[model samples]
Each structure stands twice: as C-alpha cells, then as structure tokens.
Target: MSIARPDLPRRLAAEALGTAVLVATVVGSGIMADRLTEDVALALLGNTIPTGAILVVLIMVLGPISGAHFNPAVTAVFVARRELAAADGLAYAAAQVLGGLAGTLVAHLMFEHAPFALSPTVRTGAAQWLAEAVATFTLVAVILGGLRFRPEAVPMLVGLTITAAYWFTASTSFANPAVAIARSVTDTFSGIRPVDLPGFIVAELVGAFLALGLMGWLLAPRKPTTVPVATPAE
Candidate 1:
C-alpha cells in the first residue's frame, strides 16, 4: 500500500535519525576533545565549531522534512506553539533520547576498551546546574525567536546561538537533552554524570516553557492600519 506524506511515523523517524547523527558527532568530537585536553583551545575550536556548523546545515536541510527538533526541549516548544501534537512530541522525545544513547555508545567504542568511565571532568554542582539553566534559557530564547520572527534564518541563527553558547556557557552549553544523554556514554570531556542529567534536562524543559510563553507576548501581531483604497474614475 502507498503511504501519505507527513505521516507521523515517517516524520518521527526523520527526527530520530537526524538526532542520532547530531548526537553521535557531538559525543564523538567531544571524546576527541576530552582525550586531547592537552590543548583545550585547539580541541574546542576544532571539534565544536564543526559540530555546530553541521547542526546548522543539517537542521536547514532536514528541518522542513521533520521540523528540525533534534532536542526534546525544542519539540516541547513546538508543542507549546501548537505546531505539533503532544503525542508526537512525546514520541519525538523518546526517539531522541534513544538515539542519543545509541550515538554515545558508538563513541565509547571508538574511545576505549575499558569500561566507559561513569565520571566526567566537568563536575556537577550548583554552579553547573545554574549554568545549565542559563544555557537552556538562552538556547530556547534564540530558537523560539527565530522560529517566530525569522524562520528564514533558522539554521544560521541556531548555529550562531550554539557556537556562542559553547564559547560562553559554563556548562559548555548542554542546551540539548539528546546531546547530554549521548555525552554520558563517552565518559570523555563531554560526558555528564548520569546522576546529573535529570536536573539539567528538567531545567531545559522549564526554560523551553518560559520561552514559549514569552514568544506569545513578543510576537503578538501589531494592529493593522486601515489603508483606504482610492477610487479611480469609473
């Protein structure tokens, strides 16, 4: 039997695959960075910039096909916007989380044979949680702003947002739940303790909700001015 387009299952698959590729690259590059900490500057610029660029391109390329919501928080925002159904959002989130686990596991294989370290050097604490909150807020803000005001500038703006967050956010911008889950598998520089993932993810969801609400206020339509049409000689 032939299938109709925009099918939920098909769209969800796209979300999963896109998220898998993104998280895989993220964790992979981060592993390389962690392993190459001897030169932190070189590692971050080389590994992270490319990852950000890839995300921008992939989202631009795949966003229309699947809404480009590689992050659960992003999906949640779409739900808030009523652009996606809550059931679909839940499925997308589940797919992304599973995809993240798979990608990180692959990175682990490339990094070492020893049982993957359950520890990450970034260390978890109040400071880190606060950083995550800030990072998440920033990410949600830019993403929603672009979606509301300038869908045309999507991938580019998102790329800039992530790169800036990486450069500035203390948590190294775990602005994505999927990326966080993937990081855990590597036990590398990018890894976050499994114990700490929940707090950050929760913070991110909250940030997304806040951003979704603000967008209503920020992008509300301006009152239309009446432009009377001049009557020409009949």
Candidate 2:
C-alpha cells in the first residue's frame, strides 16, 4: 500500500501544530488541577487524563502528515531506523521544541500567569533518571510494537501507555524532551526544574535508542524453516 507523503513544509506544520496542542493540554490541565485541588494525587490525576486524551486526538489527526512525532527522542529513533531523513528529522525536532514553548505560553496566558517563569520543581537523582529511562523505553517500545502489529491502534496505544506511565514513573513520565523543556518554564504541577533537564533528556535518548535496537530485532519477520520430509520406507 502506498502512503501519501506530504511535502516537507506541510509535514513540519502538522508536527508543530500537533505538538503545540499537546503541550497546551498538558500545561493547562496541570495548572487547572493545581488550582482546583489541594491534594497532589488528585491534581496529578487531573493532569494525566487530559494529556492522554489530547495525545490520542493529536496522533489521530496528524499522524498521517508527519507521523506525529512530537517527541525529539521518537524522531531520532525514526532517523536511526532510516525511515526519515536526517534533515527532516532535525526540522521536526526544531518545530516540536518551538511548538512546545508556544504551548507553554498559551497555557500561561489562559490562566493569567506570567509568560515565562523558571520552574523550581526539583526533579533529579538516580531514581528519577532511571524512571525516565524506563518510561521512555516503554513509550518507544509501545510505539514500535503498535506500528509493527496494529498500525491503526498506535494513537490509543501511545495515549494509554503515557497515562499509565504518568502514575508508574517517579518523574511523572516526562518522556518527551520537548515537553520537558517547555514545562521547565512553568511553575506548576507538571513542571520540572531546568537544572535537571539534562539528566532526563539524556536518559530519554538512551531509552529511545535501546527500544529501537530491541524492537528492531524483536519485530522482524522470522524466516520459515522447511522440515525435511522423511522418506517412507526408503
């Protein structure tokens, strides 16, 4: 089956727009949750659901355009797999980062907060890094596995995986570097400290590479072996 590959400009626009909406959903939900409740757990729940739902919507709407790679780590994996050109992948990453920042600004405007503020949320340490690695590994694995087996279900698979990871991981599964960087400018429930960004981004990249390596082999088609037929009374 032939898939329609849009021009580079349109693909980049889709990526940027999709990522913008995704981060806006994340940041806006987090701010709203923080204000609506004193319980941290409840606020987290509020943030997780909207983020997941928006991922589903965004991927469904934009996947056909740019493969909906809102995360730089994911884009890198595709480039490594030879599915996307290096230049286009770089462009996608740039758009995603800019879109993420724009999303943060939009969320802040909606809540009447300052345009940009450094986050003081201290999220660091070995445990946090390990959690990020695991979260990103699982996220990439889910994407690859879904594409391998059920191309139609990738959106739901990603959304559900992220929703679950939000609760399971220590750093709340800031699995996407672009989103993590954008969140650093917000002092809200979903924000991470700028100082800790390196660890998370490195871990995410490591995890993505690991998943690509493992899934590349695991999902490959196995050659069928022919059994030698036994001669009947020969």
lDDT, each prediction: 0.77, 0.95
Candidate 2 per-residue lDDT over residues 98-208, each given as its tens digit: 999999999999999999999999999999999999999999999999998899999999999999999999988989999999999998878889999999999999999
lDDT for predicted candidate 1 compared with the true structure? 0.77
At residue 3, candidate 1 shows an lDDT of 42
* CA displacement after TM-score superposition, residue 165 of candidate 2 (Å): 0.2
Superposed Cα deviation of residue 16, candidate 1 (Å): 1.2
The parts of candidate 1 lying over 4 Å away from their true place are: 1-5, 35-37, 111-117, 224-234
Q: Write the per-residue lDDT of candidate 1 for residues 1-234, one digit (tens) a residue.
A: 964457787777778888877876786787677576778877777667867887888898788778888899888888877888899889999988887776666667767634345655454777776777777777778877787779898788888888877878778788888878767656666777778888888877777777777777887899999999999999
True lDDT of residue 41, candidate 1: 76
Q: Which residue pairs in model 2 clash with each other?
A: none
- Top candidate, metric TM-score: 2
Off by over 4 Å in 2: 1-3, 231-234
